[model samples]
Target: MATFPLEPVHDTFRAIATTVVPEAVALDRAGWERLEEIIAEALASRPERIHRQLRLFVRIVDWRARWRHRERFVDLDPLQRTRELERIERSRWLLLRRGLWGLRTLIFMGYYAQPAIQREIGYRARPEGWDAVRGAGR
Candidate 1:
């Protein structure tokens, strides 16, 4: 069976997303499904190694949290999850830290790219910098 965010690490991945974006905690079931679709789309074009790394890193987070908090990351209190993620973000291994950063970037991209979120944030395209878009089909 597949996990919602991505399997074999979706529990931790979802926990991480909610920690990174507290607003996500309030998302409805359908909203979470949509966000997962968006996140999957972002990963679909990546190299296989990227996919493997993400799975590995997410699992590592779960294991580390278990060691530190005596519970699955998904089961930890929100503050504990956030602090654990912060510790990983400050890891001495550069690659490890960058992986978390990449994960965070992905979450932001998936969360903010939703049409409702874009509208809520008052995002709109401005074509003034390059006239090509303004004149297209004109």
Candidate 2:
């Protein structure tokens, strides 16, 4: 059977992604699915060690929720999820903090990579530069 390696943590990543970028919560089903596919494609080009580290970090976030709140990361309320992520972002350990920031960078990349979001934000980059985009503004 064909499979996506990122499938195992997609749900956990969904919660983490939405928590990192709250606006993502408003995305429709197709948009969300595309976001996952995009993220998977991005990760696919990276080395396997980075892949393993990121997947482990995702699981750690989920387990940390249960350890601290007696609930899974996805099962937590929005407020709780935000607070949990914020705490991790401010973690004292250098590696832990780095991991959170790296994960967040990926989150932003996946979210902003959406064409709709790019249009909403008025971002249009053309190889020909400003001259090409000028007409699009009119």
Candidate 3:
């Protein structure tokens, strides 16, 4: 029931999320499964063009990993995977780096903003105080 074309892409994204967020290690099996589901849901809701672009980007990363290390990105050990991604993060091609950056940002934001995570981190939502700073004339 994945909105994406290939389930492997979801696996790759899960691997990437795990690599980027060490906190993910603390998640139980069900938590990890739910996290992957959350990421897939996020990708499914993007515009068509963006969805395709992100998919293509994952394919490219997979290819790059195999070409460089004779293994898929998800197959690489944690250290190797981190090193490879770091290389991509420093790419001269702005698009490649930016795409990964955007994906990483989305993954981290989604994971950390979960209500359970918020409570675990003691992140209490506060009422907006902007009214206090409104113009006196208003």
Candidate with the greatest TM-score versus the true structure: 2
Ranking by lDDT: 2, 1, 3
Weakest 10 consecutive residues, lDDT, candidate 1? 1-10
Count clashing pairs, candidate 1.
0
RMSD of 1: 4.0
Write the residue-wise lDDT of candidate 1 on 1-138 in tens digits: 123336577778889999999998877877777788887887777777788888888888888988988899999999998899889889998877988998899888878878787787797655575576567659
TM-score of model 2 vs. true structure: 0.85
How high is each candidate's TM-score?
A: 0.84, 0.85, 0.77
At residue 96, give the lDDT of candidate 1: 79
Clashing pairs in 2: none
- lDDT values of the candidates? 0.82, 0.85, 0.77
- What digit string (tens of lDDT, one per residue) describes model 2 on residues 1-138? 222345678888889989888899899988877777777787777787888888898899999999999999999999999999988988888787898998898789878988999999999777889888787779
After TM-score superposition, what is the CA distance of residue 33 in candidate 2 from its true location, in Å? 2.3
| Candidate 3 stretches greater than 4 Å from native | 1-8, 33-45, 129-138
lDDT at position 61, candidate 1? 87
* lDDT per residue as tens, model 3, 1-138: 344333548778777887889787688877765565666677776677887787788888888999999999989999988998899999999998998897788678758867788899897664655554464338
